[model samples]
Target: MKISARSVAATLRDPGAWRIVLLHGEDAGLIRERATQAAQVITPDLDDPFRVAILGRDAHDRMVEECTALSLVGGRRVVWVREGRDGLTGLVKECLATRTDTLLIIEAPGLESRSKLRALLEKAKDCAVIACYPEEGRALEASIRQMLSEQGVQIDPDALSWFAERASPDRAATRAEVEKLFLFAGQGGRLTHEDVQACIGDAASVSLEDAAFAAMVGDRTGADLAIERAMNTDRMNPIGAARALLSHIHRLRRVRLAMDAGQGRAEAMSALWPQVFFKRTEAFGRAVAIWSADALMQAAVWTQQLELACKQTGSPDIVLCKRHVARLAAQARIMARQR
Candidate 1:
C-alpha cells in the first residue's frame, strides 16, 4: 500500500499489518525521521541496542540474512537500511515476499511513478511505501503553523512568512528551524517577526541567497563573508559548496540576460526558477539592477575557475574557499563601481 509521510501516525497505529516499510524521499533528513519513527513502533525500546540493526547499501546480503533469522533476544527486531539504493532492491523484494516477524525499514532516494522499488512495495500485499516530498508554499506554511501550535506558541502572520522565507527547501530543516524558534520563544510565548529575525540566524536559505546576491551586486566583502560562514558554520562539504556557488552564478547570469531582453523583475525571477523564498525575488530584482549581462557572464567564468581551484589545488579547503570568495567579492565591488 502507498502512503504519504503525513499519514505516518495513522499507519503506525496499526503496525501489525505492515511487515515491510519503504520510506523514500529526496530529503535525507525527513526520510530518516520517518524511518526512525516507524522503527520505534516495531522496536519500542530502540535504546536496547541489540533490537535495532542499522545497515547501509553495501550490506545487502547480510541484511537479508539477518532479517530472515529469528531474533535470539526475542523482542521485535527492526532492520533499518540507510541509503539502500545501489543494489539492495532485489533482496528487499525477496524479504517482503516471505513474511517474517521482523520489520524491514528501507530508506532510499526519491522514486518516480515507474520506479521498480516503489512499484514492488506498492503492489505487495504486506508492504507499505511512504513518499515524503519537500513541503512548499501553503503546505509548508501550514506545517510550520501546526508545529508551533503543538508547542503552545502562537506566531504572527509576518513571522510565519519570515520563517518560511528563511527555512531550507526541505521539511526536516524547516522543522528544525521552527523548533529553534520555539525554544527561542520560551515554549509558550507568542513569536513575532522581530523574534524570528533575532533568533532564526541566516539559515541555509539566506546564506545561499546572500552569497548569490553579493556575487551579482559585486559586493565582494558580503559574498566572501557569506561563503566563509556557510563553509565554517554550516559545515557545508567543499565540493557541495563549490557546486552551489557555481549554480547560483549561472542562475544570476540567466536572470541578467532575461532582464536585458526587457523582462520585468518578476519575469526575470521566474526565468531563474528560484526555490520558495521571498528573498529569491528580491535577489532577482537586485541582480537585475546591479549586474549587466556582460558582468553576469564574467561571474560564470569565475565560478568555473573557483571550482577547478578547489578540486585540483592541494591547499586546505578552508583557505582555498576563502581565497575564491574574496576574489569574487572584489570582482563584484569593481563591477558595481564601473556601473
Candidate 2:
C-alpha cells in the first residue's frame, strides 16, 4: 500500500506485515532513520551481525539471492539497497515478485510523478514508496515548532520563524539545526531568536551569507574575506559556492529591475521570481541604497561574465572559484562607490 512519510513512522511502529519496503527521499536523514527502524524490527537483537546486509546496484543480484536463502543464524534478515537507481529497478521488481520473507529496503533520489519504479511500488501489495521534498516557509516553521515542543522546549513565534528561515533546504540539516537549538536551550528555558542565530547557523552558512551580503553592499574587502574564509574552511565545494553567489546576484538584479519600474521595495522584493531570505533584507537594503538601476544592470552583466569565465576556464576548480570571487568583489566595490 502507498504511504506518506508521516505514515511511515506509525506504520514502522509495527512492521510485521511489511516484508519488502522502499524508503526513498532527498532527505538522507529520514531515509536512513526509516531504514534503521525497519532493520531493527526485522532483527530485534542488535548484536547479530548477519541480520543486516547493506548493498548497492553492483551486488543487487547476489544480495537478493542471499536474502531469499534460508536463514542460517538469524530469525529475520534485512537487505538495504543504498543508492539504487534505474539500473537496478528491474532487479528490485524481480526480487519483490519472488516474495522473499527477508525485508528489502531500497533508497534513492526523489522520483517524478510518472516514474516507473514509483508506479511499481505503488501497485505492489507488500511494497511502499515515500517521497521527500525540500521544506520552506510555513511548512518549515511548523516542523521546527513541532520538534521543539516534542523536546519539552518552548520558543516564541518570532524565534520559530527565525529558525525556519535559516534552516537548511533538506531534512537532515533541519533536524541537526533543531537538535542544536534544543541542546542550546537546555534546562527548560525558552529559546530566543538570538539563541537560534547563535547555535543554529553554521560557520559555512555564515560565510556564504557574508559573501552574498558583501557583494550586495559593494564591500570588496569584506566580500574577499568572506570568500577566503569559505574556501579555507574546505567544507564547501568551490563550484557550489560560485553557483550560490550567482543565484544571489540574480535575485538582486530581479529585485532592482522591479523597483526601477516604479515599484516599492516591498513590492519589488515580493515580486522576486526566486525565493529570498529574511536574512538578506539588510544586505539588499544596503545594495538598493548604494546602487542605481543602471548600476545593478551593469552588475548583472558582470555576473554573467564571471559565470562564463568560471565555466570556460581550464584552471583548477579552486583557482577558477577564487578568480571569480575576486572579480565579483572588485565589481561590487566599484558599483558601491558609483552609487
Candidate 3:
C-alpha cells in the first residue's frame, strides 16, 4: 500500500492490485509526471475523454462514479483526480471497497503525514501512496542527467554539474529549463561546458551562487559584485539571493559540523549532499576550512533573519540583503585572520 521511494518507479510500472494511487509532494512536476505515467499504464490516450476523467477538487463529488464506470473503448477507465484534498477521503475509500476496473490517480500536492486520505491509501491494500520531495545535490544532478538521457541529449560530465548548479530547486522550473536545453541541443546533440554556459547559464543564478560562496570566505569584493549583479541583472529578487545564500551557509555548516565530529575535512566535504558544484569546489573548500561550526551557525541565523526581513511589504529588500552580506563578509575576514 505504501510505496518506498526505492520502489516507487517499479511499482508505478506494474501496479497489479493498486486500483487507487495517490501521488503527494512539494514537487508538483514530479507528481504530475508520476500520475501521468501510472495512468498511461492503464489507458494510453489520456486525451481521450471516453477513457479518462479529469476531476478538480471542487468537482470531485462524482469521483466514485467515474472510478466505477467502464470506458467506451472497452478497456479499463482512468480517473484522474487533481488537486486532491481531505474532502475526497470517503469517495476514495468507497472506490476501494467497490472493486472497480478503473485505475484512479490522485494528485495531492500538499498532503500532510497525518492526512486521512494519505493514511487510508497507505493502509489499504488496494491503494498505493508515493511521496515526491525535491531532489538536491547528487540526486538533482542525476535527475538532470536522466532527463537529458531520455531525451537523447548528451552532455559532458562537467557541463552537467554546471547546468545542475543553475537548475532551479523546484521540479517544474527545472523541467522547463531542461526542456529549453532540449530544444537548444536538439536530438542526439552533445553539450559541453561552454555550450551549457551560453544557453543555460544566466547572470542572476550564477551571481547568486558567487555571492553566497564569496560571502562565506571573506571575498568582500567578489561578494559585493556578485550581489549587485544578481539583484540588478535579470530582475533577480533579493529574497531569492538571500535564500541561495542561506542554503550555501547551511551546506557549509553541515560539512563543518561533520569535521567537528572527527571526520577529516576532505572526507566531510566529499560526503556533502548535492556535492559542491565543480566550479565552486575550491571556494567552498576554502570557506569550510576558514569558518568554524559556531561561526557558520551564527551566519546561518543572520541569513535567515535577512530572508524574513525581505518578506516585509515594500521593504528595501536589496538593501537589507546587502547589509547581511557585508556583515557576513566582515565576519569571514575576522575568522580568516584568526586562522
Candidate 4:
C-alpha cells in the first residue's frame, strides 16, 4: 500500500495491518520524522531494548534475527532499520516470507522507480510505502495551521502564508520555526504578518535564495558574495546549495518552455511557488529571458553531475561548487548578449 505525507499519521493509527513500513523520499528530515513516528506507534517505548531494535543496513543478520524474535516483555516488538538500501534486499525478503508480527520500519533515501528494494517493498502484501515528497503550497499551509492550532496559537491568514513560503523545505526546519512562533505568540495572542517576518523569516535562507537568483541572472560578484554568506554565515551545505540551484534551474526550464509556447511573461512568472518576491520580480523576468529552456535543462543536468561527483569523490566541495556557479553565470551572460 502507498501512504502519502498527509496520510502518514492516520496510517500509523492502525499500523498493524502492514508488516513492514517503508518511508522513503527526497526530504531526508521528513523521512526521519515519519520513521520515528511509525516506530513509536509500534513500540511506545522506543528505547526499550526488549521491545524495540534499531539496526543499520549493514546489520542485516541482526535485523533479520530481531524481526523474527519474540518480545521478552510479551508486548509489541519493533525492528527499526535506518539507511535502507540495495544491501537489505535479501534480508527484507527473508523476513517478509515469515509470519512474524514484529513491526518493521525502514527509512531510506529517495528510491528510483525501478529500484529493486523499492519494488520488493511495494509489491509485498504486508508492506506500506510512504513517499515523503517535499511539502509546499496547500499541503505546507495545512501543516503550519495544524501545528500552530494544536499549540493553541492562532495566526493571521496572511501571516500563515508568509511563514509557509519562507520556511525551509525540511520538515524539521518548518517545525522549529512554528515552535518558535508558538512560544512567541504565548497564550491566546494571535500572530501577524509582521511577526512572521520579524521572528521566523530566516536571513541565512534568504541569502542562499538570493545567491541562486544572482547566479541565474549572471551577477557574478553578487552571486559569489551571496554564496559566501550562505556558506560561512548561514552554514548551508555545498550539496544543499547545489540542489537549490538545480531546483531553480528546473523552474526556469518549465517557465521558459511555457513562454516559448507563447505564455506571457506575467503568466510564466505567476506560475512559480513562494511567488517571486516583489523586489526580485524585475530580475526574475530578466532571468527568464537570459536562458532558453534547453540551456536551463543542461544546467540542471550539469548541477546533478556536480553534486554526484562531490559526494562520490570527497572533493573540496565548496571550491567545485563555486566554480560551477561562476561558469553558470558566465554562460548566462553570453546567452543574454546573444539574445
Candidate 5:
C-alpha cells in the first residue's frame, strides 16, 4: 500500500511480502537511495548477474519477460526497473499479477497525483508505494543525525543545527556534506560546532547564522557586524532575517523550558532542532542560566512583532530590523550582567 520515506527502512525488513515496490518522489536522490536499499534487501550482491536483473534503457518489455522467468541461480530473484515512467504501467501490472519469485523494484521521478504506476501500486494488496518528498526543519535534521550515527559519528548539537540549516534539499548533497564532516572529524572523533563553521561556511548564509548566534549570546558588536554583512553583502531581506531570528529564539525558548522542567542543560539543548552550536555550548549554558524561560518567551514575541513590522506599510523596514536586533543584543547584555 502507501508508505512514507520515514518508514521505508522498516518496510525493507520483510520486503518479500511485497511483489512490486514503487519508489517515486520529487527528490530523485532519495528515490535512488531507497531503491538501492531495497535492492540490497532482496539480494546481498548488487552486481550478481543471475539473481538480479537490471533493466536497461527502453527495456520495459524485457523487464516483464525477466520478472516471469525462473531464476537460473536458484534463490529469490530481483527484477529492478530503473528510470521508471508511465510507459511501463502495462508491463508492471502484468508482472505483478503473474510473477511470484521476482521482487520488482521501480525507481521513478516525480509522479503526479493521478500517475497510473503510482496509483496501481497503491491500490495493489501485494505492492508498496513510497513517497519521497523533500524533508525540511527537524525532520531533515533527524535524518542527518541518524545517517551520521549509523557511521559511528556523533555531531555536536550546535554544529549539527548549523550544518542542518545549511544542508541542501538534495539527499545526495546532504550526504556529501555529512561525509565531509565525517572525514574532517576522523574515525571515532566527535564533530564540534567549530568544525561545521570551518567546513560548511562557503555560502553567504553563514553570516545569518552568525548573526542569530551573536544575538542570542549578547554580542552586540558581533551581531551588528554580521547583520550588516548579511544585508549589504548577501542582500538578504529584512523580513527573511527577522524570520530566521525568530526561529532561533523560539528554539531557545523550547530548550529553556525543557531545562526548567528538570532536564539537564546538555539534555535540553540537544533536544532542540538546529541545536545549540558546539562552540557556543558554554555560552549557551550561560544564556540558559542568565535568562529564564519567561524571558525567552518574551523574546520570541518581540521577534515576531519585528517580523510583522518589516512586512507592514510605511515603516522603514531596514531601520526597524536594525533597532529590533539591537534591542535583542541589549537584552542579552543585561541578562548576562545580572547573572
Candidate 6:
C-alpha cells in the first residue's frame, strides 16, 4: 500500500505484514538509504552472506532464485534489488503473491509517480511504496534539528537558520555536512552561526539565491557574477539555476496573492511554508510591495518556460538560462522605474 508521509519512518523501521517494499524518488541518496533501512529490519548486518542478497539491475534469474530460496541462516531473507526499473514489476508482483519469507526491497530512484512498478506497489495490498523525496523548508530544518539533538549537540536559532539555508537539497550531501558538523561540535557542544560557517560553509547555494535576487532587483552586473558562480559548480547546474529564478517568482507570487486577498504584510509572510530565508525577508518585503499579482504571475510563466527550454535534448542550458535571467532583469528595471 502507499505509505503516507507521516508513517514512512515507522513503516520502514518495521514493514509488518508487507511482503515487498518499494522506495522510489528523485533523490537517489534518500532512496538508497531508505532501502538499506528496510533491509536492516530483516538482517542486522546488510552484508550477511546467507540472509541478505544484493543484486544488480535486471538480474531476472538471480532475483527469482533468491526470492524463492530459503535462507541458510535460519531467518527471513532480504533481497535488495538496486537500480530497479519497470522490467521488475511482473517479478515483484509474482513474489508478492507467493508466501515467501523474504522481504523484497527495491530501489528505484528515478521512478515517476505514474511508473508502472511504483503504481503497482502503491496499490497492492501486500506491498509498501515509500516516496523518498528530499525534505525542504521547515521539514528539512526539523530534520537537521532532530539529527543534531540525537547527537547531543545544540544549535542556536541563528545558526540553524543559516545552515539550513545553505544545506544541500540531496540527502547524502546534507548528511555528510551534518556529520562534519557533529564532529566539529563534539558531544554536548553548542553550534553558533560562526561555528557552523567555519565547519560547513557552502557558498554555491548562497550564490544561487543571490543570483535570483539580483535578477529580480535589476542588478545586471551582480546577477551576471552571481549566476556564473552559482552554475557549473560541483553543487549546482544549469537546470538548478533556472529553478532558482522560478522559485523566486513563485514565492513572490504567493505573497502578492495573499496581499491582494487583503492580508497585512506580516500575515501574508506567515503563510510561507518553508518561511522566507530570515536574512532575505526584508528584501522580499520590498519586492512584494513593488510587484503586482499579475506581473508576478507573468514572471512565473516566463521562468517556467525558461526551465522547460533548458530541459530539451542538447540544449545550451547555461546560455539560455543567462539570457532568460537578463530578460527578467530588464523587466525588473522597467517595473521599478514605473513604481
Which tens-of-lDDT digit does each residue in 238-286 have in candidate 3? 8888788888988899999998899987889878755676667899989
Using TM-score as the measure, the top candidate is 3
> Runs in model 2 with CA error above 4 Å?
1-19, 25-27, 38-103, 108-119, 133-149, 153-181, 187-200, 219-232, 236-241, 260-263, 267-280, 289-294, 310-339
Note the clash tally of each candidate.
Answer: 3, 0, 1, 0, 2, 1
Q: Write the per-residue lDDT of candidate 5 for residues 12-111, one digit (tens) a residue.
A: 7778878988888888888878887888888889999888988865776798788887878788888888888888898887887783778998988777
In lDDT terms, how accurate is model 2? 0.71
What TM-score, to 2 decimals, does candidate 2 have? 0.66
Model 2, residue 102: displacement in angstroms?
A: 6.0
Off by over 4 Å in 3: 215-220, 249-265, 285-317, 323-339
What's the lDDT for candidate 3? 0.86
lDDT tens per residue, model 6, 2-79: 989998888987865578898888888788878877888787898788998989964754787788889876989888
lDDT, candidate 2, 1-339, per-residue tens: 688757866777766577667766677766766677777887866456577777876777675586686667847777788876656668776777676688787777665567677778888877767665666777778777878888888997767865676677877777777788788998576887667778765566568778877866767778778877887775676666766676776677777777778888888887653344566677787776666667666666765665566666574766766666676667667766675
User: Where does model 4 exceed 4 Å of error?
Assistant: 4-7, 204-339
RMSD (Å) of each candidate, 1 decimal: 6.3, 5.3, 3.3, 6.7, 5.6, 4.7
Error of 4 at 6 (Å): 6.0
For candidate 4, the lDDT comes to 0.83
TM-score of each: 0.60, 0.66, 0.82, 0.64, 0.66, 0.72
Better of 1 and 3 by TM-score: 3
Instruction: Pick out the ten consecutive residues of candidate 1 with the lowest summed lDDT.
Output: 271-280
Worst 10 residues of 3 by lDDT: 272-281
Clashing pairs in 6: 1-127
By TM-score, the better pick of 1 and 5 is 5
Q: Evaluate model 4: give its TM-score.
A: 0.64
